[model samples]
Target: MAQKSEIEWTDATWNPVTGCTKIGPGCDHCYAERFAERWRGIPGHPYEQGFDLRVWPERLDQPKRWKKPRMIFVNSMSDLFHKEIPRKFIDQVFETMESAHWHVFQVLTKRSSLMRNYIRKRYSDRSVPSNIWLGVSVEDKPHASRIEHLKQINSPARFISFEPLLGPVGEIDLKDIAWAIVGGESGPQARPMAEEWVVEIRNLCERDEVEFFFKQWGGPRPKSGGRLLDGVEWNGFPWQMVPEPILERLAS
Candidate 1:
C-alpha cells in the first residue's frame, strides 16, 4: 500500500493483494508485471518472488490507518478477483473497504465474470457500498463482454478502463456505466491503437453521459505522445457517483 501514487486519476494505491498472472491481450505488456519482475531475486523487496499471485493480509487495514480521505486504487498491482484468490480472502478485502469507509476504493480487474460473481454473492442481500467502485480493463472488442459483466453488478459507480486499447470496440451501449478511461499501449513493444477507434468510444460516451478520460496517446513511454484527443485533453471524472460524505470531505 502507498500513501501516494503517480497515476493521474487516483490519490493513492492499496495493494492488499500483490502480483498477478497475465490473462488477456491487455495484459500482454503489463506495466505492473514489468515493475514487479524488476525486483525479483532482490531479497527483502516486496516483490522478491516476482509477478506471482500473493495476498498481503497484513496490508488489508492500510486504508483505515490513514486519517484523511483519498481516492485509493485497490489492488493496483494485482487482480483482486483472479481465479486463484479464495472467496474468503476476497471477503477480507471487502471487509476492509467497508470499514475504511472514509476513502473511495477503486477496484479494477480483467477477470469480469469472477468479479461479477463475487460481488453478486457478497452484496446479494444489500446494495453495493458507494465508496467502493468496481471496474474492468479491456484491450479490444473481444473483451467488451467485460463491460456487460460490469453492468450486471449492483453498484452505480461502475467504470471501464480501455487502456492499451488495441482495436475498436465497435457498437456498444454504455447506458449504466458511470465512467470510461481509454488509452493506447505504452512501453517498448506497445501496440498501435487507431484514432477512429478512440473517437468512436468517445462519441459513445458522449451519447450515454458516461465520463470519458483519455489517459494518453501512448508510445514507447506512457507520455511519449502526450494526452491530447482532437487537440484537447479529455479529463472527465465521475464525481457525481462519489458518495455525498466523501464529496463533502473532498470539498472541505
Candidate 2:
C-alpha cells in the first residue's frame, strides 16, 4: 500500500528510494531529513541509517499494486535524480511509473540538469507518459535556472515548486509550465516569507495563465499564519492535464 501524505498538492507518497544530502539553501530545514534522523541508530527502522542516501529495490513495484487511482508524489523521502542512486535503479522507478498508467506520478527534484538528461536518455524513442509530471524545486531567484532545465524536457506535463520561498524570484518565464506551488518555510528557525514575494509569484503565474496554488504562510507550523493569500485561498491545480481515464476514475 502507498503511504498517504499530508502534503496538500498530492494525495499520497511513494518512496522506492530513501535519504538524501542537502544540496542548497532550500534544504536547510528539510522535513524529510529531520524525520529520518530521529530514527537513526534504531534497530530495524526504515531510516536506521539516518538521512544518508539508501536505495530500496524491493519497493520499486509498490505503485503497481495500488488499484485506486490517486496522485502519487514520487520519492517524497528523497530525490530520485540524486547522483549516488544507480541509473539502473532509476530506470526501474521510471518503468514502474510508466507501467502504472492508472496513477498520476509527480516527480520533483532539485537536481534539475540530471533529471533533464536522464529523462532525455530514457524516453529518447518515446514521449513521456502524460500520467507523469516532471518538476524542479525553485527556492529563489538564483535557482530559477532550474526552470530552464525543466522547460528543456520534452514532456508537456511540467510544473514548479517554490516552497520555502526564501527570496523574490525576481522574474520568471512560466511558459509551457502547467502548475506552480508557492509556500513559506515551516519549522524551527524557519526563515520568514514576505507577502510581497508571494504576490509577485502569484502575479507571474496569473500572467502566464498557469494554475497557481498558495500552499501556506510559513511560521512555527505549516498553518501557523493560515493559507489565506490576500484574504482568499488559491487551490489551483492542473485538472486538465490529468489523463482522461484516470481523471474519470478519480472524479467518480
Candidate 3:
C-alpha cells in the first residue's frame, strides 16, 4: 500500500521493496533507515532487515491492487537497482508496472550503471512502459555524471532528483532530460544548503525550458523552514512522452 505523502514533489509513495544501504553522502541521516530501526521490534513489519538491502517479493503486486490512476513514487524506502536485488526480481517489478497501465510509476535510483546494464541485457527489447517514469539521484558533482548515464536509456520519460542537496551541481546538461526536482536535506542533524545552490539550478532549468520542481528549504527541521522559496512553490512536471501531436492539444 502507498502512503499519502506530504512530499510536495510527488503524490504518493510505494515501497514494493524496502531497506537500502548507504552508498553516498546523501545517504547520511537516512530517513528510511531511521524508520526501519524504529519498527524493528514490530511483528510483520516490512523493514525487518533494517537497512541491509532486502526485497519483499510479496509486496510486488501492490500497484495492481490500486484501481485509480495515480502518480506513484516507486521504492521510496529502497533502491530498485540495489546490487542485492536479483535481475529476475527487477523483471517482476517491471512486470507489475507493465500490467498497471493506469498508474504512473516514478522510479529513482542511485545505481545507474547496473540499471543501464539490466535494461540493455534482460529488458532490452521491451520499451520502457509509457506509465513508468525513470529518474536518477545526483546529490553532488560526482553523481552529476549519472544524468548522462540516464540519457542513454530509451525510457519514455526521464528525470533527475537532486534532493538532500549536499553540494552545488552547477550547469547540468538537460539534453534528453524531461524534468528536474531540487530540494535540500532535512532532519535533526541536517546539513546546510546554500540559497545560491538552489537558485543556480533553478536558473539553469529555466534557460533549458525543463520543468523544475522545488521541493523544500530543508534545514535542521524541514517543518520550520518549509518548502517556500521567494514566496512561491514550484510544482512543474515534464510530460515528455505526450506525443507532439497531442502536445498542441494540451497547450490549448
Candidate 4:
C-alpha cells in the first residue's frame, strides 16, 4: 500500500520490499534503515531482520486497490534491483505496474548495473509503461557514471534523484535524461549543502531544458532547516511522458 510521503520529491511511497544494506556514501544516515529498526520485534514486520533485504509477496497487489490516480514512489524502503531480489519477483512488480495504468510508478535504484541488465534481458520485448518512470541515485562524482548507465536502459521516462547531496556534482550531462532532483542530506547527522552546488545543477537543468526539482537545504534536522532554498520552493516534475494534450489542459 502507498503511504503519503514527507519527501517533497514524491507524492506517495509503496514498499513491496523492505530492508537494504548500505552500499555508498548516500547510505551513511539512511532514513529507511532507522525506520526499519523501529519496527524490530514486531511480528510480521516488513523489516524484522533490520537492514537485511526482504521481499513481501503478499504486497504485490497493493496498487490495484487504489481507485485514484497517483504518483507512486516504488520501493521507498528498499532497492527493487538489489542482488538479493530475484528476477522473477522483479517481473511480478512490473506486471503489477503494467496492469495498474492509472498510477505512475517512479522507481529509483542505486544498483544501476542490475537494473540495466534486467531490463535488457527480460523486458526487451515488452515496452516500458508510459506511467512508469525509472531513475538512479547519483550522490557524488564517482556515482555520476550511473547516469550514463541509466541512459543505456530503455524507459519511457528517465530521471536522477541526487538527494542526500554529499558533494558538488558540477555540470551533469542531461543528454538523454528527463529530470534531475537535487537536495542536501537530512537527519540527526545531516551534512551541510553549499548554495553554489544547488545553483550549478539548477543552471545546468535550465540550460538543457530538463525539469528540475530542488528538494531541500538539509541540516542535522531537515525540519528545522525546512525545505525552502533562496526564499522560494522548487516543486517541479519532468512530465516527459505526459501527453501534450494533457499538459495543455493542466496549464489552463
On lDDT, the candidate that comes out on top is: 2
Name every residue pair that clashes in candidate 3: none
Q: After superposition, how far is residue 188 of candidate 2 from its true place, in Å?
A: 0.9
Per-residue accuracy of model 1 over 175-207 as CA lDDT, tens digit each:
999999999999999998889999999999999
Every model's TM-score? 0.98, 0.98, 0.91, 0.92
For each candidate in turn, give its C-alpha RMSD to the true structure in angstroms: 0.9, 0.9, 3.1, 2.4
Stronger candidate by TM-score (2 vs 4)? 2
Candidate 1 stretches with Cα past 4 Å from truth are none
Off by over 4 Å in 3: 240-252
Give lDDT per model, in order: 0.91, 0.93, 0.80, 0.82
Candidate 3: give its CA RMSD in angstroms: 3.1
TM-score of candidate 2 relative to the true fold: 0.98
Provide backbone clash counts, one per model: 0, 0, 0, 0
* Pairs of colliding residues, candidate 2: none
lDDT of 3 by residue, 7-54 (tens): 776668888778888889989888778778877757777655666677
Score residue 174 of candidate 1 by CA lDDT.
Answer: 95
